[model samples]
Target: MARNRKSVARLLIKAPVYLVAAWLLGFGFFVLTLPKAIPDGMTPKSDGIIVLTGGAGRLEAGLKLLEAKVADRMLISGVNPVVEPHELSALTGAEEALFTCCVDLDRAAPNTAGNATESNLWTQTHGYQTLVLVTADYHMPRSLILFRRAMPNATIFAYPVKGEWPMLYLANEYNKYVFTLIGEAFKPAPGDAGKQAKSATGTL
Candidate 1:
């Protein structure tokens, strides 16, 4: 009985250590696999482009892609409610006509997950089968995971923006990515809100 108790205690103590080791390994792998840059002179055609806010160069890149005719439409997700389309046009140096005709502003999303939700809705509304996702390099993994979960049928291409990120930012993002992965694994899939909305609208 004493030997069995000792064995149980040993297992209990080592269990957390083993778990920590596994988590560290996973994080390391994630860091190594993180996207460094979008390829130069490579324009991937998609049904639309979705740019998540909170990083420099993303909106401009998406706008350039749109101007290059890589996609016919673009959704700037997570826009501040105060900002107008004209303001974005001025900031991006994209023509006002382009913004008026093909660019959309989404002010509903407040975070990355919310960005996915808003993008999914917009994609369904626009009937976008493929999307070029623009965000920071550090944010791409988690963004991709949530976006994929939210829009399983859509083909997503990552266009990560390379930047000088602080160590703290990288660490926080890495932790969040791991936690999201674990949470997603256990969470049950809810019915597609976008599809339901599309069905009701009877449009794209």
Candidate 2:
């Protein structure tokens, strides 16, 4: 009985250490697998483009793809509710005419999951079967997972925009990415509000 009690106490003490070690290992794998840049094989051609909000230069990249005639339509999901359409046109240096006919701004989605859900709806409305997803490289993994889950019937391609990021930023994003993966393992469907509390904080 005494030996059993001692063994249990030892196991309890090692449990947290094991967990921390496992987390560090997983984080290392995540960082190593992060996309360094958009690969040459990932062509720009798709029926539509999905530019997830909250990252610098993502909108411009998507617009450029559209301008290059890779995609017929572009959806800038998760646009701030207060941001006017005209303001986005100016910010992206895209002609207002493009926005008038080809681009759609989504202010309803507040996070990656919402972006996927709303983008799926927009694609269904437009009948776009193939889509290219654009977002910061650090965020591309989680975005892809949620997007694939949300639009399983749609052919989706990843177009991660690489950025120079500090280790802290990478670590923080890694945690969120892991969290998203874990949540997705059990959730049967994509949600409209994956991170509602983080909405006001921006860059959810």
Candidate 3:
């Protein structure tokens, strides 16, 4: 009993070191795999810009890109329906016509999947074959999953917005990735939201 107790105590001491090492390795992997900068010459010629709103700086980044002529039009997903276009223009400091002409305030979507559905509709209706997806750097991976599932045929290019802090962004990216993996493993099969979004958009 005494020897067994010693062995268990030793294991407990070593367990924390192992856990710490594993976490550092996982974080390092995520950082290494993350895209350092926006890809060169990724300007989409077929479709408009689809900006998913979640991170603090995502919308501002998307608007700046639009103002720079990165794409012909912009779809700001997850917008609050009550906010007026003129209000957005005042917030962005761009002309109201810029928002009215080249932008659509999508209020239906409340998440990434919704962003895909709404943006897909906007793109298809506008006859755009290609699209540039803008979101925070940490969100690009999961965003790709939802977007690809929503718009299987459309060419998609990711234009990740720079985050405020590199460490925080990396932490968020890996945390979301792990959470999603676990959620997929144990969560019951896809239900109404995903199915309805997929069916409504017809993204087979």
Candidate 4:
């Protein structure tokens, strides 16, 4: 019994260390795979485009893609409620007509997860099956995870924006991605289609 107790204690102490090491290795791999530069002349068409706010140049990139006819519809997820479409066009230098007819502003999402939820609903509402997802490169991994969970049937293409981000920001995003992965692992399988549709439409 004494030998068993000692072995148990050793295992308990070593478990956390192993877990942390595994997590760090996974995080490093994720960082290494992130896009370092924006792709040029590689525009692939999709059913629509969804841009998650928070990163610089993301909106402009989305708009440019739309202008290039990459997709006919676009959603700027997580927009501030106060910002008008014309104001966004002015900021991005996109023509006002482009946004007036084809763009939607989603003010409901307040974070990456919320952006996924809101974009999923918007895609469903518009009958979109494929989407071009625009966000910062460091954020794309977590964003893709949540978006895939929220809309498993949709085809999502990442269009990561390259920018100068501080190390602290990258580290924080990495932690969030790790936490999200762990959380999703233990989550129960989603319910039927009706229930899922209702859940996606509701606020996160």
Ranking by lDDT: 4, 1, 2, 3
Q: Compared with the true structure, what per-residue lDDT tens digits does model 3 show for residues 1-204?
A: 999999999999999999889988988886767655575455555358888876777777777778778788999999887988888789867888888789988999987768888888888888887888888767887788777767778888888776565687678668777776665567445364677788989966
TM-score of 1: 0.82
Residues 57-162 of candidate 4 have per-residue lDDT tens digits of 9999999899888999999999999999999989998889999999999999999989999998999998999999999999998999999999989999889998
- The stretch of ten residues in a row with the least summed lDDT in candidate 1 is 187-196
TM-score (all chains, Cα) for each model: 0.82, 0.86, 0.71, 0.83
Candidate 4 is scored at a TM of 0.83
Which is the better candidate, 1 or 2, if ranked by lDDT?
1
Candidate 4 clashes between residue pairs 3 or more apart in a chain or in different chains: none
Model 4 / residue 61 / CA error / Å: 0.8
Where does model 4 exceed 4 Å of error? 1-23, 36-38, 190-204
lDDT of 4: 0.90
lDDT of 3 at 124: 82
Q: Which scores better on lDDT, 2 or 4?
A: 4
> Which pairs of residues collide in model 2?
none
Q: Per-residue lDDT for 55-118 in model 1, tens only?
A: 8899988888888888999999999999998899899888899999998999999999999999
- The number of residue pairs in model 4 that clash at the backbone is 0
Residue 30 shift from truth in candidate 2, angstroms: 0.9
Q: Please, what is the whole-model Cα lDDT of each candidate in the order they appear?
A: 0.90, 0.86, 0.78, 0.90
Stretches of model 2 off by over 4 angstroms after superposition: 39-44, 188-204
